[model samples]
Target: MGTVRDILQTKGHAVYSIHPDITVFEALRVLVDKNVGALIVLDNEKVCGIFSERDYARRVIVKGRASKETLIREIMTENPISVTENDSIEDCMVKMTEKHIRHLPVMDHQDRLVGMISIGDVVKYIINEQKYIINNLEGYIKGTR
Candidate 1:
């Protein structure tokens, strides 16, 4: 079973974040530059919320709010669902599914932000693990293991 730690190790622990006070337009620019769907929202170096493309679509575009004037904090999902490095990939998937969220912030033992994982990350890890298992099993059956 793969853990969040495994994913972080493979993906690198680089978390892009934005200040809560930034305008939605600024956040959107960062999202484009990063090529990611979501960002961890930080305030005073602490995780405060998550800002995503979904938030922009539903809150700003749909509501006719000006992206240049609207604050990210007003639309961001505050106190987002998070997981720790020790958590298994399956656990993270369940949480994301139940919460209807695509991204999850990864925290450390002291509640410090370490990295972030998306649903795509979890699915890719699982698929890789399955491929490894299948290869090993095939080798065993063929007397190659």
Candidate 2:
């Protein structure tokens, strides 16, 4: 019954993003500073796409594209799959698996970008839910609940 809100509440929904027109080098600096694998490519504060360190390696460095010369939009994944805050962790997992992605941005009912979630976050929430269920069952068995 747990949702992304639970994970966000614990892990925080604050996101680090970059503008689409910024050079790949600038985006790289933000990624390194945040120690995150990806950055939300924004256009006027709206989620435009997503760029990851992987994209830079595959599209820029390996392909002879200069990081300082290339733009994030040139390499970013456009219109990334997004979810709502009310969505269950299970729903998020299915979407990521079908899409073969590791990250998903969460939004509100009005489609306002809220936070980002990773596969690791989904796994952690599931583990915590299982533990809670087990603990409650044990307590009930011991007549303590």
Candidate 3:
């Protein structure tokens, strides 16, 4: 039941982004260097698109486009779905499942990009929450208060 703001607070609001004009190869390098599965495409500090390993596989490799030659703008998912800090983690899970996406960019009230969350992040948080609930239930059953 935690919000995106809680996740950002725990994980830190570090957003990795790239320009659309960059080559897919360059973007891949950034992905590898940052150890993230996706990058937000920003133009003039505005969210424009998103590039992911899935994008590279489906858009570049499947289409026989060379990463070194293909620009990110040519393959990135334009107008990607985003979530606000106030949105609940469960809401994000539903959105991601419905959209068939693994990553989401977190935005502030002003529509400024604040962070990014992956499916792994959400799953981990939910699992931890469940563990806490179970522990509390067991403690209550034992009259441990």
Candidate 4:
């Protein structure tokens, strides 16, 4: 019965991002330092795209481009799919499955970014919910609420 907001509360909603103009080198540093898989690429405080490790491997490493000279925007996934906070974890699971993305940025009803959720978050919540249900069932069998 927990919500995405609940999971975020335990994990923290801090998202690491960078400007589109930043060098891949700088972006890589931030990614490594933050220990995150992706970043919300910002332009004037608005999201333009997302940069992930896959993007670097595909666009820069495979293409033989120097990370130090390449811009993050060039390799980021443009116009990436997004989700809102009101959306159910089920809804997010469906979207992520269809799109094959691991991270989803949660927005408010007004479309302002609020938090981000990863596939791991969804799995954790689902697992926790199952455990809670099983415990409740055991308690019920024992004539407890």
Quick one: best lDDT, which candidate? 1
Error of 3 at 142 (Å): 1.3
Ten residues in a row with the worst lDDT in model 1? 90-99
Give the residue spans of candidate 4 off by over 4 A.
Answer: none
Cα lDDT tens digits for candidate 2, 2-103? 788998999997899999999999999999999898888889878889998778888999999999999999999999999988888889999999998889
- Candidate 4 lDDT, tens digit per residue, 43-110? 88778889988899989999999999999988999987888656778888889899889988877777
lDDT of 4 at 44: 83
Q: What is the TM-score of each candidate against the true structure?
A: 0.98, 0.91, 0.97, 0.91
Provide backbone clash counts, one per model: 0, 0, 0, 0
lDDT of candidate model 2 versus the reference: 0.91
> What TM-score does prediction 2 earn?
0.91
At residue 120, what lDDT does model 1 achieve? 94
Candidate 2: worst 10 consecutive residues by lDDT?
52-61
Candidate 3 overall lDDT versus native: 0.96
Q: Rate the local accuracy (lDDT) of all candidates.
A: 0.96, 0.91, 0.96, 0.86
Better of 1 and 4 by TM-score: 1
**Predictions ranked by TM-score, top down?**
1, 3, 4, 2
